[model samples]
Structures are given as structure tokens and as C-alpha cells.
Target: MAIRNCLVTGAGSGIGAAVAELLSGQGHRVALAGRREEPLRELSARLPGPSLVLPTDVTRPEDIESMFAACEESWGPVEVLVHSAGAGDSARLESTTDTMWDRQLELNLTAPFRCVRRAVPAMRKAGFGRIVVVASVASKVGAPYVSAYTAAKHGVLGLVRSAAAELADTGVTVNAVCPGYVDTPMTDRSVASIAAHTGRDADGIRAKLAAAQPIGRLILPGEVAAVIGLLVQEEALNGQSLMVDGGSVQS
Candidate 1:
């Protein structure tokens, strides 16, 4: 495998950290972007290959620019991009506030749009690149009690598909990976929040979430990471939203 210069957003933890570490292990130079510096710094030191720690809030256009600039400066053009920075809430539309609606869209949908602007140009110039958006099962199907989350993630799929169409003939491929009930820190928080709201124990809520997957368990972060690694190298798999939900949202 060629030593591609890759940039992964939300690299401090969850799917982003998993993808970044896996890419680094595959001999790629990774640029880690996240709000927290300490975790990125720690992950960078532990990576198998060289990495740049660019503590960035992906929602900010200026931060996105600086992140790409820093990565290019250190490792040349970024040949691969993984967008995993996302946040959402579990609220019905009637109960959702303006802040909740906007933040979900901004973080889950708009940030990828912003990051791709920085990536596509560099990728187009080089005539080779890969872009993967870490979307959700909510993007594919409707789930109750998380209207804002579902909307934003559905928007993410739209963005990914549109970008994929436009860049089809180009070497730059855009796609999405939709995961369901992953075993990560973020999911732990979600489980806790659901428990608080429903007056159920965390274990029960977790079991319910896991049972949503036909495989009867939570998906591992590394399982999703493995698919991302393949997408980065598989030129033919473009304009796709590969679901890693253990058959939770099968089409």
C-alpha cells in the first residue's frame, strides 16, 4: 500500500480514533483533528506511523482550513479524508429546541461539507483520493425519539451521495459508513442519557440498543475501522453508503 497522507476528523475518540489508528497502522501519515488536544496528542504518540495533531473544531471553516493547511505543510497533500466528527440528541421533534436542531445539523451534516471543500481540491489536483463520512443507521432509516439526529444524519447521506456523483469520474471517491450501536465512549453516554430519560437501568437500555442489531450485540469500533481501511484503498467502491449496522437497517 502507498503511504497516503490522510486526515481524520474527530480523531480523539470513537470511530475517528479507530479509523485514524488503523490507517496509521497501514503505513499512512495521519493528521488527527478534534476539539481536545491531549487525547489527540496521546493517540499520535501511540500510532504506528507519523501523525500530525491538529486540534480543530470541524464546524469552524477557519479551523478546517488551518487543519488542512497544517496537514499539507507537514505531509504534503492529503490523499485520504475521513470525517467522523458528529453529535446529536435523542429528542422528539416536538420537544427539540432550536439549539438542538441547529447543533445536530452543524456538527453531523455541515462539518463534513466544510471539510470536503478542503479535501476535494487537493485530491483533484493529485488525481487520487478517498473520502469517507461516518454517518449513522439513522441516516438510512427512521428511529423514534431522535428526530434531529435522524434529520441531520439523513442530510449527511444526501451530501455524501451528491459529492460522490459529482466526483465520480475523478479519482476522488466520496462515500458514507453508517454504523448502528457501536461500542464506544459516545455510545456509553447515549446509553446513560436514554436511561435517565426513560427511567430504565443503563444495562437494560444498552441491551435494547444492542438487540436492535440482528447480530444481538454492539458493533466494535475496530469493526467499522476495518471497512474504512478498505474504502480508502478500494477505488471501485464509490458513490456508496456502506452500512455496518449488523443488519439493523438493511435495504
Candidate 2:
């Protein structure tokens, strides 16, 4: 296996953190990017090898450019780019404000676009790169009260597929990992929202969500990270949206 210079966005927590840590452990030089500087610094300090912490807001083009520049300066050009920065919003169409929709789209869809756009030049130059977009199960299944998030994720899948096709013959691969309910801080917030909306206890709501999945539990962050690790392998997997939803949606 090659020692990749990897850049993982939203690496301060959840699946992003797991992916960054795992890649770092595997002897890859990883650059952690996120809004929270403290967590990114802490993760960098704990990881093996030289890990760079680029505290950045993915929604900003300048910030994205700065992060990639810093990564390149510290660890050379990024051979692996994992776009795991996203946010979910729970709101019905009638209740969702234009601002909320725009915000979600900016963070969930356009942020990845910016990152990918910035990475493509370097990747093409190297002629060997791996790109992974972290989408969601909502991309496949339309869930209620999350129209904006679902729409953004669907767009992400489309973007990944298009990029994959464009780079098929090149030594680069573009793919997406669509995860179901992962047990992360975001899941906790979702549980709280459900409880508040339905007047149920947090544990009860969590139980209901778990039972909704075929596996009878929320997916772990490490589980999703494992799928990401597999996607970056030097194989023929391209333009595929691999679901890590524990049999939630069979696609």
C-alpha cells in the first residue's frame, strides 16, 4: 500500500475523525480540516506521523483553498481527499425557510464541490488520486421533514457519479459513501429533536430509530470509516455510491 497524503474534511469528529485516525494509523500523512480548531489540533496531536490541522469552514471557497494549500505545503499534494463535511436539517417544506435551505445546500453540497474543484488540478497533475464524498441514505430514500438535506445529498451523489465518469480512465477514482443513521453527535441531536417533537423520552426515541433499521441499532462511526478506507484502495471501484446503512435501503 502506498503512503498517501490524505486530506479529510470535518475530521474533528464522527466518521471524519474515525477516517482521519485510521488513515493516520496506517502511516499516511493526514490533514484534518474543520471549523473547530481545538478538536482538529487535538486529533492531529494524537495521530501518528505528521498530521496537519487546517481549521477551515468548508462553505468558504477561500478557506477551502487555504486548507489545501496548507496541506500541500506540509505533506505534498493530497493523494486522497475525503469530503465528510455536511449538516442535516429537519424541517418540512412549508416550515423550511429559504435561508435554511440555502445554508444546507451550501454546506452539504457546494462545500464538497469547492473541495473537489480545488483538488482536481493537483490530482490530475499527480495522475493518481482518490476522492470520497460522504453522502447519506437520504440521497436514496426520501424521508419526511428533511427535504433540503435529502436534496443536497442527492446532488452530491450526482456530482460524485459525474466526476467518476470523467476520471474513469485516469488513475483517479471518485465515489460516495452513503451512510444511514450513524451514532454520532448529529444522531444525538436528531434523537433530541424527535423526543421534543413527539413528547417522548430521548431513550425511547433512540430506541424507535434503532428499531427502524434492520440491524436494530444505529451504525457506528468506525463502520462508516471502514467503508471509506476501502473506497480509497487501488481498485476499480468508481462512480459507485456504496451504502453503509446496515440494510436500511437496499439499492
Candidate 3:
């Protein structure tokens, strides 16, 4: 396998951190980008290979440019990009505000879109690149009380497919990994939100979520990272939204 320059957003923790760790172990130079500098630096210190800790807010275009510039300055253009920075909040459709809707779109859909836009040009010139967006199973299916999140995920999956088609002849492949109820801090927050909204026990909500997957357990962040590792290594897998859920959506 080639040791490429990789950039992973949301690398402070969860799926992003796992992906960064896996790539670094495989001898890739990784750039850790996240909002918090401490965690990024902490992750960089532990990585097996070279790394750059870049604090960035993906919601800001200027910050995105700065992140790419820093990566370019350190190890050259990003040959592999994994966008795992996202958040989800639950609300009934009627109660979902414009702020909530926009936030979801910005974080989940627009940020990845911009990062791909920034990376693809160089990838086309080099004729080799891998881009993976850590999407959710919500990208595939609709559920109650998460209309905004579902819409954003669906749009991001569409973005992946369209971008992949456009870049079919290029060496760059665009794809998304859709995992269900991953055991991450994000899911922890989801559990809290659901419990607060429904006046249910948080532990019970979590158990219900785990059982939602046929495997009857929350998906592990490393499991999703392994799937991302596969996408990064395989050039033939483009424009596919792979389901990392335990056979929940059999697509």
C-alpha cells in the first residue's frame, strides 16, 4: 500500500480518531483536524507516523482553506480525505427550526462537499485519491424525530454518488460509510436527547438503540474505521454508500 498524505476531520475522537489511528499505523502521514486543539494534539502524539494537529471549524470556509493550506505546507496535497465531523439532534418535524436544519446541512453535507471540492482538483492531477464521508444509516432510511438529520445525510449520500460519477475517469474515488448507532460520544448525546424529549430512562433508550441493530449492540467506532480503511485502500469502490450497521438496511 502507498503511504499517502491523509487528512481526517473530527480526528479528536470517535470514528475520526479511529480512522486517523488506522491510517497512521499503516504508515500514512496524517493531518488531524478538529475544533479542539488539545485532542488533536493528543491524537497526534499517539499516532505511529508523522502528523499535523490542525484546529479547524469545518463550518467556516476560511478555516477549511487554512486546514488544506496547512496540510499542503506540511506533506503536500491530501491524497486521502476522511470527513467524520458531524452532529445529530432530535426534534419533531414541527419543532425543527431553521437553525437546526441549517446546522445539520452545514456540518454533515456542506462541510464534506467543500472538503471534496478542495481535495479533488489535486487528486485529479495526481490521478490517485480516496475520499470517504462518515455518514450515518440515516442516509439510507428515515426515522422519527430526526427529519433535519435524515435530510442532510440523504443529501450527502447524493453528493457522494454525483461526485463519484463526475470523477469516474479520474483516479479519485468518492464514497460514504453509513453506520448505525455507533458507540461514540455523538450517540451518547443522542441518547440523552431522546431521553429528555420522551421522558424515558437514558439507559433504556440506549438499550433500545442497540437492539435497533440486528446484532443487538451498538456499532463500534473501530468497526466503522475498518470499513473506511477498506475504502481508502480499494480504488474500485467509488460512489458507494456502504452500510456499516449490523444488517439493518440490507442494500
Candidate 4:
């Protein structure tokens, strides 16, 4: 395998951290971008190959620009882009405030769009690039609450599909990995939030989330990372949303 220059957002923990480990272990040069410098620095220390720890908030356009500029300066153009920076919030549509809606769209939808726009021209010029979005089962289907999050995810999926088609002939493939309830810190937060609101035991809420997956357990971060590794290596799999939910939502 070629040692590509890869950039991954949300690299402090969860899916992004897993992807960083997998790609770096394979000897790729990785640029880790996240809001926290300490975690990214720690992850960079443990990576097997070359890496840059960039403290960035993807929601800010200036921060995104600086991230890419730094990557270009350190390495060359990014050969692989893994956008795993996202968050989930649960609230009924009626109760969801404008701030909540905007935050969801900014982080989950618009941020990736900006990153893709910034990365694609260089990718098209290189004539070989991979863009993978770590989406969620919420990207494909709906739930009772989490309306804002679901909407943002669904919109991002649409973005992935449209961009994949547009860049299909440029040797740049765009795809998504939509996993169900993954065992990550994000899910932990979700469980805590639900417990606080409903006055239920956190463990029970977590158990319920696990059972929602067809496999009767939460998906592992490494499992999702493996799928991302596949997407990054394969050039034929464009405009595809590979579901990693253990047979849930077989689309």
C-alpha cells in the first residue's frame, strides 16, 4: 500500500482516534485535527508514523483553513480525508431551539462540506484521493428524538452522494460509514443526557441503546475504523454509504 498523507478531524477520541491509529499503523502520514491540543498531542505521540497534531475547531472557517495550510506545509496535499468530527443531541423538533439546530448543522453538516470543498481541488489535481465521512445510522433512518442531529446527518449523507457523483471521474471517491450506536465517548454522553432527562438509570439507557442494534451490542470503535480503512484504500467504492450496524437498515 502507498503511504498517503491523511488528515482526520475529531482525532482526540472515538472514531477519529481509531482511524488515526489504523492509518498510522499502516505507515501513513496523518494530520490529527480537533478542538483539544492535549489529546491530539497524546494521540500523535502514540501513532506509528509521521503525524501533525492540529488544534482546530472545524466549525470555524478560519480554523479549517489553518488546518489545511498546516498540513500542506508539513506534508503535501492531503491524499485521504476522514471527517469524523460530529456530535449528537436529542430533542423533539418542537422543543429544539434555533441554537441547537444551528449547532447541529454547523458541526455535522456544514463543517464537512467546507472541509471537502477545501480538499477536493487538490484531490482532483492529484487524481487519486479518498474522502470518508463517519456518519451514523441516524443518517439513514429516523428516531423519536434527536431531530436536529438526524436532519444534519441526513443532509450530510446527501452531500456525500452528490459530491461522489460529481467527482467520480476525477479519481477522487467520496463515501460514508454509517454505524449504529457505537461504543464511544459520544454514546456515553448520550446515555448520561437521556438518564438525566428521563430519570432513568444510565446503565439501563445504555443497555437499551445496545439492544437497538441488531447484533444486540454496541458497535466498537475499531470496527468502524476498519471500515474507514477499507474506504480509504478502495477507489471503486464511491457514492456508497457502508452501513456498519450489524444488519440494521439493510439499504
lDDT of 2: 0.91
lDDT of 1 by residue, 143-175 (tens): 888899899999989999999999988888998
Model 4 spans > 4 angstroms off: none
User: In every candidate, how many clashes are there?
Assistant: 0, 0, 0, 0
Give each model a TM-score.
0.98, 0.98, 0.99, 0.99
Which candidate do you rate higher for lDDT, 1 or 4? Answer: 4
lDDT of 2 by residue, 138-165 (tens): 8898989999999999999999999999
- Write candidate 3's Cα lDDT for 145-221 as tens digits: 99999999999999999999999899989999999999999989998888887899999999999999999999999
The TM-score obtained by model 3 is 0.99
Most lDDT-accurate candidate:
4
- Clash-forming residue pairs, model 3: none
Candidate 3 regions with alpha-carbon error over 4 angstroms? none
Using lDDT as the yardstick, the better of models 2 and 4 is 4
Q: What is the lDDT of residue 223 in candidate 3?
A: 98
Error of 3 at 124 (Å): 0.4
lDDT per prediction?
A: 0.91, 0.91, 0.95, 0.95
Q: Give me the displacement of residue 83 in model 3, in angstroms.
A: 0.7
Q: Per-residue lDDT of 133-153 in model 4, one digit per residue for the tens? A: 998999999998899999999
